[model samples]
Target: MQFTSEVIIATYNKPDYLRLCLKSIAEQSQRPTSICLADDGSDARIDPVIEAFREAHPDLPLRRSWHEDQGFRKSVALNRAIAGSTCDYLVFLDDDVILHPEALARHFSCATRGRYLTGSLIRLDADLTGRLLEAQSYGWAEGRLAGWTPKGRSQWLKSMPFPSGVMALFDRLSPVAPNFQGACASVWRDDVLRVNGFEGNMSYGGLDKEIGVRLRNAGIRGRHVRYTAPAYHLDHGRSYADQKVKSANRAYILALRKSGETRAVNGIAELDAV
Candidate 1:
């Protein structure tokens, strides 16, 4: 069965970043059925920003909604957007990232018989240069390979083999994989709803980790699109970095593991529960 997914771009106060993100989405080789802008209660600035874009691209399938400031619980904002939409698949992205030209087409093309499909991100500096390349150029981190493309750069990727012991260790560490960024991923609409959207408690950190865990618990296999359909993350000040915030994220993960509650977040049910 073939289906088209609506790309959801979640934004907050960063109007400049929002414009860039939307521009990238606008130039996609295969445009999404619609672009849903889910704002996490921002100041009046966002309205003008969105309106400007809307005026520029009158035919663009752009939708907008805003909610009150909900602390660090971005999951709540995401769920709110999901509940407000009607699409076969959901493509999730952060506001500070730019998609490759074929991002949406590749994601939907490969989303078969799985609950989730995750792509890798190339972490670029604020200036949009390759960090690894910079390290090699400055003779900081010695490199064995001349030009190694990190996972999720494009559709073509090379395979490398490691020892069985190392592979076993890697499998054990699946729950805490370092590259579990949900910014460049997609999920079946039904599968996401079945899992009850995201855990409302995990607002700031660990929200991505917790949602990934739940998907795994529900027997949803994750397909990594490393070196394929890569998105670029625009680096900025890590405002979400705080000791207290990380602790709260860790506690939430522990609770998710202990409770073992796995269910879909249906839109109607979400409204009724709230």
Candidate 2:
């Protein structure tokens, strides 16, 4: 079955990274129906970046949903994007993650009903990320093995194209369970609506995992797409990541998971009811 997909990118004030992200999206082999930029709270600088991208790719549907930059309210911004989207499937990306040309196509091919796909990103070191951003060009393939080295069980799958049979075999036998990394993952729109979207109260840290747990509790399974849909992740400082807040959020998510709570109290439902 063919599924319509939309890419929803959550951003703050990273215009350079966002520009690269959009450029990667523009190069997708199987482009999304639309791109919804979920701006948490950014200044006016992001406007020209989006405008330039729109002018460059007029055929690609792009929409921006912005709110005041009160704090790191990523969940609220994502909730707004989810509420605004009109597609069968939703791919969530971070501002610093640049996709491979085949990333979206692979994700769509691996997509199954009642399940979400969690992919991985190869981290690009500070120097490489800076050079690429400064050059305003994305040579993802050339820099595939630039900063880090891939090891472990699935190391052979890095930056290699496999036949359809191999992809199917890997998708079936892969031992990795679905752990939602907001940087690269895809889920169905109905499933997200079923859980009322993400919890707005969450700050960071286990925020994505909370929704993954809830989705599993609601009977949706997690599919691992680590090598199949790998992307390039631009490295940056995490100055805004508050350890205390993340700890509290993780504890709250654990409590909710233990209680088997599926729907978030202040998620998409609350926003829609308003």
Best by lDDT: 2
* lDDT for residue 67 in candidate 2, whole number 0-100: 83
Worst 10 residues of 1 by lDDT: 136-145
| Model 2 root-mean-square deviation | 2.3
Tens-place lDDT digits, model 2, residues 1-274:
8778899999989999999999999998889989999999889888899999999999998999888888778988999999999899999999999887888998888778889989766777788888888977866434243444555435546454565456556766767666887889999999999999999988868888889999998989888777667687898998879999988987897788789889988898787553
Q: Estimate the TM-score for candidate 1.
A: 0.76
Q: Taking the tens digit of each residue's C-alpha lDDT, what string does model 1 give over 54-133? A: 88878777887567885555777778888888888889999877676666776777677555877666665544334422
Best by TM-score: 2
Q: Which residue pairs collide in model 2, if any?
A: none
> What shift in Å separates residue 81 of candidate 1 from its native position after superposition?
0.5
Query: How well does model 1 score by local distance difference test?
Result: 0.66
Residue 261 miss distance in model 2 (angstroms): 0.9
Whole-model Cα lDDT of every candidate shown, in order: 0.66, 0.84
Clashes of each: 17, 0
State residue 181's C-alpha deviation in candidate 1, in Å: 2.7
